[model samples]
Target: MGGDQAPQMVVAGLRQAQKLHPNISFLLYGQEKLLSKLIPSDDPLRAITQIRHTDEVVTSETTVSTALRSLKKSSMRLAIQAVADGEAQGVVSAGNTGAYMALSKLTLRAIEGIDRPAIAALLPTVRGLCVVLDLGANVEATTENLVQFAFMGSLFARYVLGIEKPSVGLLNVGVEELKGHDKLKMAQLVLKNNPLIENFYGFIEGDDIAFGKTDVVVTDGFTGNIALKAIEGTAKLLSNFLKQEIQKSFLSKVGALLAKSAFSTVKHRLDPHRYNGAPFLGLKGIAVKSHGGTSAYGFSSAINVAVHLIENKVNERLAKDISLLSQHLVQEMENLSLAIEKPTPIKG
Candidate 1:
């Protein structure tokens, strides 16, 4: 309901997704009466799109527990339950992110060894796509959680992004080992010692995000969210600046016309619509959160992402990988603890 276009944009995206992938089906969860009014009566989509009506709508201000308690007839809860109940492969929404995340985690539950599910977003870089994890899912995280994020994110890059042995870098204030807070220092120690973590690059600063120095950058939600918003804001500002500069004079307008093709290419390269959705990783099922202001193209891109995740079995793969790594770490720590606890027999 908080989405800028709400049902209209969702319907538009659904139409485009059906055209792109005929095998994909949609279960619209909301006020069936309002959605019916928005969609054309004779549209063939009416057949493909199934509406699951709810008496109440989950709002942004609704608490997680409140939302769950009120799930007697709520659209978001129904949508999440669909995935958990095997009715739907995944769930995508442009509604309140907090509500969606809460409902999803509560219903589907987290995968084994996952402390908290993180939001992983793909950013296009000069080299290729770079995956950023913990993008506003958990504001504060522990060293163990950060290390686990690296493992899950590495899998995502390998399977979803098709990068074999993708490099993992710790997002920090500086690239030096001595830099960053205590949390990062602890995470670095674990990453360096973990044999399963491939291409464990030491550290990467904010500047390296767009430069694509590494395939995966791991950070807590607080820093990752700020960095993401900063990058997006800068992109928008630059785009606006270019447009204003190009429209200043007749000669510039002619020049713009001459450079239209090149500009279009650049726009496509930088446009967030091309990479609109982000996956909530570490969950038992695939759940994508689209931009609140997304258009048809953005939502379409989101659906494509969902399809990729489902096809790749990203959630299941992450769960398996994390489970193995977590168990190994637990055993290693236990052995170390026992060794330290034991006193030297004859030293005295």
Candidate 2:
């Protein structure tokens, strides 16, 4: 009910998702009269689907405060509430991103050791796919926050993308160690010493993202959000250029026709719809955010993401990892204190 097309896109996407996961039950939270019309009475999904009937919706212009304080009955709020109440395994929405994030945090809360939750999503790269985090969830991140994001992103890649041992990289102005700010440098140092993250690939520049330098890329929300938008714009630019050039001449048109199959393969590989879900990582409960303007297919992909995370037990694994890392750090500090107290042999 919160998307650009409201119940229409939501219902259509559910239909697509239902086909993929026939065993999964769906809970639709929106205007029942409107949503019911979209799904036929004889539809197979009707057997497993249930509508809660929510008239209120968090619109694009809805303030996060308003959504949290006043719109208790909104679809977005109720869906998240369902997750918190243990009625649903996960909740997916293409609604107001800010409102969604705020509501999710207020209800589900962050994981035990997580200072803040980060938004993580898959990006198509030359090597296959990369999980990038802090995608507008927090504008600024501390050294500790960046380190946590790296660990979370790594776990996400391993569990969701099926990478056995994912490599982690901190986003920076340059690949050099001394290039970034104090926080980045400190985060890199911490990651280097942390044994849990086996493959800390130091720092990676903007271009390395497309090349897939590492399976997981970590950055502050301010930088990650801008970088994501820039990459998206560039993809659009290149696609338009290819289409314009293909239609520019009769010879080009003939060439394009001959390579239609090859073109189709490339399009499928680079389609944004294939990577539509952006899960708010570090949260206690699962919540996936889809692009509001995405097609039904794209929304379905987002739903699949939520289902995949649940199957893999990502949140459970992440919590354990965080706990172990914290204990390791405490032990390291104790060892350092003891070493400092035991003075070195004089002139040895």
Candidate 3:
């Protein structure tokens, strides 16, 4: 009920998800009359799903503060509450991203040892998939926050992307040690020295993301959000260019038809719908936020992400890892501070 298409697309996505994970059950929260009609009696999802009616919904235009202050009984909040109360394993929504993140954080709270939860998603890359984090979760991040993102992102890649020893990289202006600001430079030092974090790949530039230079790319939300939109725009530009070229002449049209299968493969590989879910990592309970304008197929993909996180027990492992690495993180940060405070004088 929270998405652009509302209950219609939501139910359709549930149907697709049900086909993939037949054993999983669903608790739909929306106008019962409308939702009940979407799923026919013969639908398999009907047997496993139970609707919890609610007239409330968080609109795309609703301010985060207003949603938090007044929309307590909205479907989004109720679903997250279900997770917090232990009635559901996870919650997925294609609603207002700010509101969704806020409610999720307020209800489920942050996992112990995690000061802030980051938004992480898998993006298609040349090597396969790369886990990128802080994709608009935090506009600014401290050195400590970046280090934690690297750790959590690496684990996400290991568990979800199936990379045994995921290589982590800090997104920066250049791969050089002195290129980025203080936070990135400090994070690089911390990651490099911390024996707990394996395969620290120093810094990776914007182009490195598409090259899949590392399995996990960590950055503050300000940079990550811009990078994500730019990549998306480039993909669209290329796709449109290809289509235009194919229709320019009879010869080109014939060529495109002959290579239609290859074109289909390329299009499928680049489809944003394939990488729809972005999880709020480091949270106490699982909460996945899908793109609001996506189709049912995309929504189903988000549901798959939530299910995978639950199945992998990602939070449990992350909790233990954070505990073991906290002491090392503090020590590295202290070393960085001291180096900054008392720099050795250079003799010309």
lDDT of each: 0.84, 0.88, 0.89
Question: In model 1, where do residues sit more than 4 Å from their true spots?
Answer: 175-178, 331-348
| TM-score for each of the candidates | 0.91, 0.93, 0.96
Highest TM-score: which candidate?
3
- lDDT digits (tens) for residues 1-348 of candidate 2: 357876788788888998999888888898888777877679887877898898888999999999999998999999999999999999999999999999999999999988899999899999999999999999999877898899899999988999988999999886343577867766776788789999999889999999999999999999999999999999999989999999999999999999999999988998999999999999999999999988899999999999989999999999888988777656654554475469721111
Per-residue lDDT tens digits for candidate 3, residues 1-348, read: 478987788888988998899789998898888887887677778899988998888999989998899987899999999999999999999999999999989999998888889999889999999989999989999988999999999888888878899999999885344577877778888899888778899888999999999999999988998899899999999989999988899999999999999989988998888899999999999999998888899999999999989999999899888987888898888877787778722111
* Tens-digit per-residue lDDT, 89-199, candidate 1: 999988788888988898899998889898989897888789998998899988778988898889889888899899999998763545877767667766877888869
* Over 4 Å off, model 3: 175-178, 344-348
Off by over 4 Å in 2: 175-178, 329-348
Whole-model alpha-carbon lDDT for candidate 2: 0.88
The best-first sequence of candidates by TM-score reads 3, 2, 1
For model 3, the local distance difference test gives: 0.89
Model 1 clash pairs are none
